[model samples]
Target: MSQSFSLRTKSFLAGLVLPLLLGACESSVSVRGNFPDPEEVSSLEKGVHTRRDVADRLGSPSTLSTFQDQVWYYIGEKVEKTAFYDPVVLDRTVLIVKFSSDGMLEESHAYALEDGRVIDPVTRETPTEGQDLTIIQQLLGNLGKFNPGGNK
Candidate 1:
C-alpha cells in the first residue's frame, strides 16, 4: 500500500528476475561441441613401412582385437553438455589399422558416426548354458556319488 514498500518490492523483484533472465541467456549462448577429421590419420603404403613404422607415424592404437591380433583399433567418442546440464554426443571416430603376419600395416580405414554401426545390435537373448560352478562342485560332479566298481 505504501509507496516506499512498493518501491522496495519492485527493486527486490527486479534484482531476482534480472539475474534469472541473464542466466537463461547465458545458458542459451553457452554450447559445447567437437569435430574429428578422418584425414588426420595418415595412410599406409604397401611397401613403405612396417608396424614399427606405422606406430612411429601414428602413435599407438587405442585397442587390439583378440580374434585378429594383427588388427589394431582406435575408437573415440565425445559428449558435450550445454549449460552443464543437457548432454549430447557431438561426434565419434573409429580408426582401424590391420597388420600382416609379419607385423606390417596391411590395411587402414577411418569411420565416422554418420557412417553408422558396422555391427547390428542383437537383442535376441542367447540361451546360455554357462553357469557359475565352483571348482569343488565341478570336481564332485565329475566323480560318481555311488560307484559300484568303486575302489573305495
Candidate 2:
C-alpha cells in the first residue's frame, strides 16, 4: 500500500512540475541582416577597391542610402524574447560604406549598439469628434432610424 501511495505522489508531482518547467523555458531569438568581419572590412582600401570588390568581401548591403546611390549600409541585429514579453535587442551593428563617383571605396564606418541613442516613439492620440457610446448605446443607436427600403 505504501509503495502504491509513493508512486501516485511522484506521478502527481511530476505532472504539476513538468508544465511549469516547460512554460518557464520558452524563449526565442531572431537575427537579421549580414554582418561583415572586421578583417575583411579592413582589407578594403579607400579610393582603390571598387563596388564589386566590396560586395565580394562583405556581401550585399542591407540597404543603400536614401538620398544617394554612392553610399551603402550593412545592418545587423539580434533580438530575443522570453515567454510573453516584448522582444529586446541583444546586439546591433551598422556599417556604412561610401563610394566615390568613380565607384571606388571612399570611406567606411561602423556603429555598435552602444553608439546609438534611444528615441521614444510618438504616443499622443489624436482626438476625433464623436460621442463615446457604451455597448448597449451602440447596439440601439440605429434601431429606430433605419428606413425600410421604400424610396422616400
Candidate 3:
C-alpha cells in the first residue's frame, strides 16, 4: 500500500512540475540582420580595404549613409519576447564603416545598445490642401460615380 501511495505522489508531483517547466520555456529569442563576426570585422585593414573588399568580406551593409554613400552601416539586433509581453531588446550592434572619396576604408566604428540615444519624433501633422470627409460622406460621394449601365 505504501509503495502504491509513493508512486501516486511522484506522479502527482511530476504532473504539476511539467506544466511549470513548459511555461518557463515560453521565452523566445531572435537575432536579426547579418552581423559580421569579430574576425571578419578585424580582417578589414584601413586604407587597404576598398569598398569591394569590404563588401566581399562582410557582405552588403544593412544600409548606407542617409544623404551620402561614403558611410556604410551594418546593423544587428537581438530581441526576446514571451507570452503577451512586449519584446525586449537583448542586444544591438551598429557597425559604421566609413570610406574615403576614393572608396578606401577610412575608419570603422561599432556601437552597442548603451551607445544608443532616443529621439522623440516630431508629432506635428503636415496640413494638406484637401477636404477630409467622413465615412458616410465618402460612401455617398462614390455611390453615383459608378455607372449602373456598365458603360466601358
Candidate 4:
C-alpha cells in the first residue's frame, strides 16, 4: 500500500511539472519585413540593373532614405520571445541598395547582425521660450478671465 501511494504521488507531481517545464522552454519566433532570398538579391547587378528591375524582383523596399530617395534599405529581423521575457533578436539583415541619379544601381551592401551598432539616444531636453504653469495655477488664472457677457 505504501509503495503504491508513493508511485501515484510521483506520477501526479511529474504530470504537473512536465507541462510547466515544456511551457517555459517554448519560445515564439516572429519574422518581420521582406527578407529577400539570396538568389533574388544575387540577381541584381551593379550599374546593370535598374531600379524598376530591382523593385520587380525584390518588391518595394522597407524604407527609403529620409532626406533623399536615392538610397533604399531592405531591413529584416527575426525575434524570439518567451513568456514574461524581453524579445531576443535571432537574426537581422540590412540590405542597402544605392542608386545613381539616372536610376541605375550604383552599389549594394548587405549587413548582418554582427555588423550592426547600437546607438544610445540623447535624453537632454531643449529649453523653450515659455513659462511653465502648474495645473492649480492654470485653473485659478482662468477663473477671472472668463467674460460672462456675449461681448468680447
Candidate 5:
C-alpha cells in the first residue's frame, strides 16, 4: 500500500477507536441517589401504622414540621444524567410525603424536573436605593458627575 493510503487507513481506524477509548477512560458512576415513589407513600396508612412501622416501611422522614409534630415530611431528590462529560441533571424526581401526627400517611406528592424548568432561588431584579442612573452616568459611574469644564 502507498504511504498516503496507509496513513488514511490508520486515520480511519483511529477515528473509530477514539470514541471507544474515551468511553473506556470514563469513570464508572454509581447511582448515588434514590427517590421514593409517590404511590408507595400513599399506600402507607397513617391511621393504621405506628411510628416504628412507618419508619420500617418508608425508611426515614426527611423533616418533621416544627409547628406540627404530627406532620412528618419524607423528601427525596434524585438526579440522573446520561454521561459524565457535561454531568447534566438530565432527570430530577422529588417525592414529598407528609404523615400525620398519629403516624398515618396524610399526603404524597411528587415532582419531576421534566414537568417544568429549574427555578432559581435568587431573583435577577435587585432593588437599589436612591435614583436610577442615566446612560452617561451609569457608563461613567466611578468617574463621578463632577467636571471642571462644566464649572462657571
Candidate 6:
C-alpha cells in the first residue's frame, strides 16, 4: 500500500512540475504592421507600376507620408519575450514606395533594422519663471481674485 501511495505522489508532483517547467520555458512572439515581401517589391518597376497595381500586389500601406500623399510606407516589427522579460525586437523592416503625380511608381526604398537610429528621450523638466507657492499661499492668493462679472 505504501509503495502504491509513493508512486501516486511522485506521479502527481511530476505532472505539476513538468507543466510549470514547460510554461517557464515558453516564449512569446508578437508581430506588428505590414511587411512586404522582397520578391514582390522587386517585381515592381519604377515608372511602370501604377498605384492600383501596387495596392493589388502588396495591399494597403501601413501609413502614408505625413505631408505628402505621394509616398506610402510599410513598417513591420517582430518582438519576442520570454516568460517574465520585456519584449525584444527581433526584426524590423521599413519599405517606402513613392509615386509620381500621375500615380506611377517613382522609387522604392527598403530599410532594415541596422539602418535605424535610436534617440534617447529627454527627461529633464524645464523650470518656468514663476513663484513656487505653498498650499496655504495658493489658497489665500485666490481669496480676493474672484470676479463675479467674469471680467478682469
Q: Which pairs, if any, clash in model 5?
A: 46-104, 46-105, 70-101
- Candidate 4 lDDT, 21-121, residue by residue in tens: 99887999999997988899998998999999899998999999999889999999999999888999999999999999999999999999999899999
- lDDT by residue (tens digit), candidate 3, 1-152: 99999999999999999999889869999999868987999989999999999999999999999999899999999999998789999999999999999999999999999999999999999899989999999989997787898967
Clashes of 3: 0
State TM-scores per candidate: 0.52, 0.75, 0.65, 0.69, 0.47, 0.78
TM-score of 5: 0.47
Clashes found in each candidate (C-alpha, N, C closer than 3 A): 0, 0, 0, 0, 3, 0
Any runs in candidate 1 off by more than 4 Å, and if so which?
Answer: 1-40, 83-86, 118-152
lDDT of 1 by residue, 60-109 (tens): 67778888678877777776545657756666777787888888667877
* TM-score between model 3 and native: 0.65
Q: Which lDDT value does model 3 have at 18?
A: 100
lDDT of each: 0.70, 0.93, 0.94, 0.94, 0.64, 0.94
Q: What is candidate 2's TM-score against the reference?
A: 0.75
Task: Indicate the worst ten consecutive residues by lDDT in candidate 5.
Answer: 75-84
Give the root-mean-square deviation of each candidate in angstroms: 10.2, 3.2, 5.1, 4.1, 7.5, 4.2
lDDT of 4: 0.94
72-115 in candidate 5: lDDT tens per residue?
A: 56544443344445454545665555667566666656667766
Worst 10 residues of 4 by lDDT: 143-152
Worst 10 residues of 1 by lDDT: 27-36
Badly placed stretches (over 4 Å) of model 4 are 1-25, 66-68, 127-137, 150-152
